[model samples]
Target: MDEITGVFIQESREQLAEMEAGLLRLEQNPDDQDNINAIFRAAHTIKGGSGVIECHFIEAFTHLVENLLDSLRNGDIAATPLLATLLLECCDQMSSLIDVLAAGTPAPDAGLLARGDALTERLKQFIAAQTKQPEASSAALTVHDSSVEASGGGVVITDSWHISVRFGRNVLRGGMDPLSFIRYLASLGEILGIETVTDAMPAAAEMDPESCYMGFEIRLQTRSSKADIERVFNFVRDECDLRILPPHSNLADYIKHIQELPEDTMRLGEILVRCGALTQAEIDDGLHLQKDLTPEAGLEGEGTDQTPPTPPPPQLGEILVEHKVVHKEIIDAAIVKQAQVSDNKSKEARLVRVQADKLDQLIDLVGELVIAGASANLLAQKSRNGDLVEATSVLSRLVEDIRDSALQLRMVQIGDTFTRFNRLVRDVSKELGKDIELSISGAETELDKTVVEKIGDPLMHLVRNSLDHGIEPAALRLQRGKPATGHVSLNAFHDSGSIVIQISDDGGGLNKDKIHAKAVERGLIQPTQTLTDAEIANLIFEPGFSTVDQVSNLSGRGVGMDVVRRNIQALRGAVDVDSVEGEGATFTIRLPLTLAIIDGFLVGVDKASYVIPLDTVVECIELKNLPTDRNFLNLRGEALPFVRLRELFEVEGEPPPRENIVVVQFAGKRAGIVVDQLMGEFQTVIKPLGAMFRHLRGIGGSTILGSGEVALILDVAALVHAVSQGEEHRLLAPPARHKLSAVQNVRQ
Candidate 1:
């Protein structure tokens, strides 16, 4: 697809999201006029954009939806639950059309076209019903403080919109006929009155035939909005100055409109008359009074030395106020709106749209820069020159700053991601005949865009599982002394350089007995095995594990949980569950903030080096300082399991006389990694391992050091799990030297 169509599709999808969100809000508050207007605007914007790109399949269908929304906005129809549902379905269909466009499909398939026809027929019913009802004063109009009634007697009392426009001198030379725009405007509403102003026209002999000089004052009666009227001039906006005032507009609206008008040579009184702020007689009277008050008017025949009574001439604004044609407060508000408009324009100028792929490419270049900076610092330090070392150190710091800023460019708030679940929760609850409400908290937590995109599917699965199997039915909830309505919540927060998302529900918790029996029946575990509550809860992540006896459409087939775990692990993240038997259950997922460059603590085991993510490193200590028994260490009165890299990787070398123990923590669990040397900190750029290492545990990825050697980045979560699981096994079975010593002997 071309760039224009691609951008259109992206923007259309965003509008669909807004429409869905606004419709949901309207369902909650039926009398919310602001909500209704916002929904209507979203639909109108989508339809307008689609029309601009000639996507008629979308534009034609969206026109029907817009009609229904316009009826709601006009208060011709009430906001009903069925109406809200239909509007949401329209949003879905519009999204499907956008997807088809993105896929380069020339048009929708027969099935989709038929679906659109059905939606269109249903929408017409609402519009047709609205047509049968007698028109009433719109409640939506009264909601705005600018309404005429709210201003008492100090407002323009016309039921028609007033428009003032002036075509640029070069309009005719550019081959655009000003009459064409006027004719098109007539199509939207009745032209109550129109006056052509030829004041700028020169004498016939001096006039340039091709240079146009014309303007118009028009009164239009219509139900169309100001935006709809403004769009009529979109093609010639750059070649014309236009102003519009709605029906029954207040004095403040007229004053604001006057301030926004371009500087013209026309007199102030004439400008006011053209803008419909004052009648021709009212302006003529004001101008005549001002002319009489001027000292020049008293100097008849150039011989009157009367001193003109020392009276000041009245300005146009002062004259209008003095004659009670306008208000002072309106002028003050006009000043404020002008200032706000200026500030908003300045802010808009600072925003620019960038393609995502370009941003990703920039990040990749920054990662390479970081590695090159590290290599330079290494060479400088080895030379033992103070000036070179300091220079390289400063360059390294600068490179680090750039790396951080580049990564930050990819960070986005998770709120948009969290908001999408509202529709899902709403639909799923209705489908299951349950009254479930989803509450979101801590949604402002920001993470890498890559991580956020990849995390959505896993999140969907967990949420659906909670809705389907986790939350009990309304009847069962009430019988269990719970409220008839169920609650599911999605919460996110930052923890120790990781983003932790939790999906929780207030319903019947997991039945441990059922899971245990199911696991045993599937031979996932030995019948004689005994496990703690946490371990039993986590067994759900096992492949093909489910307690459901009969398969259902939602999730009884037991296919998602294992894939969820595998996907999370692919990002070097972890997922686990916790349950309270009857209280409820919560699934917690912990993932790194970014998968690109990481601050890692470099360590050596035998002749090989490994990097531990610096965020997870608590501290480092000599192994001889603590008592080490088997595979665990006693540190400050606490037992911390230690994983020996030399034995873990089966390195063939004698043990060092003294080793360092680097204490690392993940998900609130601390472990010690035994290594030969503590190489301090290093900037690590994570490179994924090849397919051959797909099943490799303990090693997450590989990185290149300053000395051009490959250092393995440890999979901290997996290693921590291995330590915990090994400890549990040692406690449950006959243990001899904790298995590491055997590996050490074999390597030796």
Candidate 2:
């Protein structure tokens, strides 16, 4: 029960987040019925879950919110900004209620209760407003929300059905209210008769308040098909034994369904009539016919021998069908449908939900197995044993495949995170009274879960900064010859073994002169220094740097851009800016696909080994460059930059005569690493640097080799950015020559 409660809370909160995002989108385009339906579904899912878990507070409040959302979905109420705001607030209230449930509190605290009440009253008002809308408006739009799930061809719809429900003991304890399901059923059609069965109930002394001891037999009469009737109990289906017999079912069908239920004192005839499947007269007539068929009926009171039976007694169902009391089609459809449901249940039972932490543990174990496999492979080759070497080689390949598959489990689509920003952008722009619109592309790009979690904050800072500073107001944008509504676009794509996220805005781009002046004024740069536009723009990342003369609520504390840079670098990633002063600015963030494990190329710098991400390694070539002072090589008429690791890290030893250059590309710039030996590919598990080594540059992380030697994984992206920022003398600074300018110079 506790485990299920934890799952319910986690999932419900996620659903609420989805709902909030959907509501924000719906506000923009109220006519988007799909988004409206999605929001409705989210609220409905959370409500159903709350009921199942017995969190009545959340369940009840969400019911009201769900009702309002339903009205919007049905076109009974138009989606307005005010209504969207109220719905978003309701999402927050649901989150708070979920928090209370998660804390294991038996009841809501005073503050929580008051907050819920306030939100509830607002939702009721909105619902009331919905009722005041003209009916003709909604009449034009469709409202077939509760249509049948499926209907077989050439089959008649069941008019009346017998639904038997025996809720589990944990239903109430788990937070589900059985009564709500009955109400839902009544909503679908008229619940003609319902008989509560308390035969399973223990004595009052032994009764537990949390336990559910109630069962019910319901007779439903509606035009809805059998599938629709079954859906009312879908939420409790997992926690209840449910059986439905179609209308006009004979005694055989009733007996079959009855026998399938748990032991109860309810008679077959009583169950049938109570479910409204059979009327009183029809059942009485059937009983009378049965009595007449009995040969000893007349001889019971007389001391005479019974008359011999002429033939075998007819079956109750056969008698009903023969008498044309029940349709053969209804009987056959009910039996066939029941069989299909039983098969579906059998398939559903095979699925199991495993916690994410369990998957993480499994991946960690797989990593160890990979290391062990590598060791075995190394030893086998050393032993000069052909069979053993071959066997371990096979093992090594399998382990590598296993590692890839394991990491894939943690790769989630980045779209979920990207869409969440729509709401943020909307709310923030509204607050600032700016007509800024956000457009997103490449939402299907996938990244590691851990990377996704950590990237959100950095992305948020960049986005908010764009809204607060980069985008000009509607009047200003119009004066600049841009559309009145400024546009901020977010684009993500997988590039060269990394995910590149670009945040661009079409407003007044960076004011380079203002930024440079601010930097010089703050002593972040030398007044005499010469820099290009891109270099000047990079000054915004310096600490205590901002062009704003006055602090604004959204930004201008001079604390954002620097932190954004640091956070991105902390993830072994890099961030750079490109902008046209009057056009716009694009902050391009390049992040690795995964931070935990990667495929790497091992290289030896004299005696020390370094690992370069395999995906970034475009190719390796023999070193023949002799460019004086400049740290670049002319490869195939292209001026590709190169860094000598032995010289950069100051590795001790005489230089190896035969050195190789491994060409790597990051963020569209190509660079090379000078090494003495190429040590082939390796599966690398990244371990973070110690606190003492945290300040080290060019080294992202440390990984253990099969020989147990620690090889530092090169921060290829950072190293390339550093080279782009400066020539041979500087590690990472503003680039000496802008990339585009340098390319043009090289081409000339």
Candidate 3:
């Protein structure tokens, strides 16, 4: 599409979306005038824009819709439920019509057109019925003619002026009707006289019924200001000749009236008579006297020194008004422009639509810039030139700033994601005949847009699961002394550089005994196994694990929760569940702020470097005299499980005399990794491993360092899980580690 067509489509789509939102609001608050006015404006804009593009069908349809809305706006039609329903259907029809236009097809469905026509006819009938009563007082003489003839000169009327209107042939076919204009004028003043001019009509056999060959000479008297009368004909002024004059008044009023007309209009004496500024006799006398004067004498009398009569200065307000640049009412509404000028001062208050692909490209460039900055810094250090070093340092800071700003562009509040669940709860609750309320908190939490998009499905699954299984029925809740309404809450916030999203429901918590029994029946766990409440609660994430006795549409397919866990892990995130017997269950997923870059600690284990995310690392300490018999460390007198990376990765190396250990904590669990060296902090740009190595455990991905060596970034959350699970198994094995140690020592 060309630029203009593209813009039209974009604007139409936006207006349609606004119309939908307004209709929904009106459904909820039918008495709200603001929402009604907003809906009207949307329709009016669509009508005007469609007219500009010459989309006659769309323009005609929207014009009828606008009329219906006008009735609502003026309170001629009360907002009955039937009217609201029909209006919503009209909005739907308009949307379908726009889609058809976008696709370069014909108009919308035939059914929609039929319904729209019926609705329009009904609305017209209602409006006509409401206006039939003679409500205006007879004494209100607002309409009067100003065409009365005078002897010396035409009597000029000011406030009480009237006009005799004459319609040319084919006016009705041109969408011009004298009655509508007359009625509009009546809204401003009373009609004194209306004489139809049929003198120009042709024979009946040559005439078309729809063609308006009649003219009107109207005499209207009014207290309305002059501008009000002009506005009544504004829309049709281009198609018809219009003139406004003052009532019978002194010469001063005539001069004032002359000054009111534009420079071109002042020369038309006939127009002045027709507009009630002068009588026809006055113009005839001027013309007759001019004919008597000799042409040569008249020309000589009008000397060059006569200087073309200077016209009166134009009204600044009127000049602004004529160009359509500003409205006179707006000036009257606000005497000062400061408020209008300052309206958009708050930059944060505006929103713009950005293509998702553009954001992705920006992030990719920032990642490359970071790697280049690192390489430059390394070269500058080796050059030993002060200028080169300073430039590189400044470049490095700029790269950091660029990376930060780029990432921030991809950060979006989770509130929108959370708000969408409201409709879900409402519909699902109604379907299941249950009373459920969704409460959300901490929705202001921000996360990477890519992660947020992927996480929505997982979050949705969790919420549906909670509502289906975790929340009890209203009767059951009441029986348990709880309120009939069940509460499901979604909360999100930042916890230590990672965004934590939690889905919780207040109902009977998971049935641990039933779950354990089911796990054993499914061979997911041993009957005699012992587990903590937290550990048992997490078993729900296992694939094909469901304790529901019978399957239904709401849930119990047993495929969702496991996928939720896997998707979170793919983002280098972790999920956990917490529950109390009868209170509720909470499922929390913690994910990194950005997937592209992170602050990492470089550690070497047997010549190979690995990166541990710096945010997860609580502290680093020397592993001097660490416990040999136990896999735990006394970290400042606290017992923390520690894993030896060298052994874990099966690296061939001799033990270093002073090994370093990095203590990392995630999801309330802490572990220490033993490494040969701690290399402080480094900016790590994440690169995903190839498909061939995607199934590899422990390593999340690899990144390039300043020295052109690839460093593997440890999946700390996965490694922690591995170590914790290993430790648990060893503890349950009844001192079998001695046999394992002998086997391990032989390998070492």
- Taken over the whole model, the C-alpha lDDT of each candidate is 0.83, 0.78, 0.74
Tens digit of per-residue lDDT, candidate 2, span 1-748: 8988998988887888888888877777889866887788788888888888788888899999989987887667878888888888788788888888989889889998898899889888888876886666421322222322234543223335678788999998778899999988898767878999999999999999999999999988665655576677767766886666566534444444433332234444454454444555556666788778755544443543554534556666555556554445534544454456566677768855677799888878887787788788888989999999999988988988899998988888999888888888988988989988889999999999888989999999999988988889888888888888888999999988899999999878898888888888888779987776777888888887888888988898889899999999999998999988879899999999987788999999876899999999999998754643557778999977777777677678876677899999988888888898999999998888999977777889998888878889998876786665554224333565433332222222
Candidate 2: stretches off by over 4 Å: 31-37, 70-76, 105-111, 128-352, 624-630, 728-748
When 1 and 3 are scored with lDDT, the better candidate is: 1
Using TM-score as the yardstick, the better of models 2 and 3 is 2
Q: Candidate 1 local accuracy as lDDT?
A: 0.83
TM-score of 1: 0.78
lDDT of 3 by residue, 454-494 (tens): 89899989999888988899989999889999999999988
Ranking by lDDT: 1, 2, 3
Give the total clashing residue pairs for model 3. 18
- Each prediction's TM-score against the native? 0.78, 0.70, 0.65
Q: lDDT score, residue 262, model 2?
A: 25
lDDT of 1 by residue, 580-695 (tens): 87678899999999999999999998788999999999999988854445778678999888788887786897888899889999999988888999999999999999999898
What residue pairs clash in candidate 2, if any at all? 51-176, 52-176, 53-174, 53-175, 54-175, 54-176, 725-734, 725-735
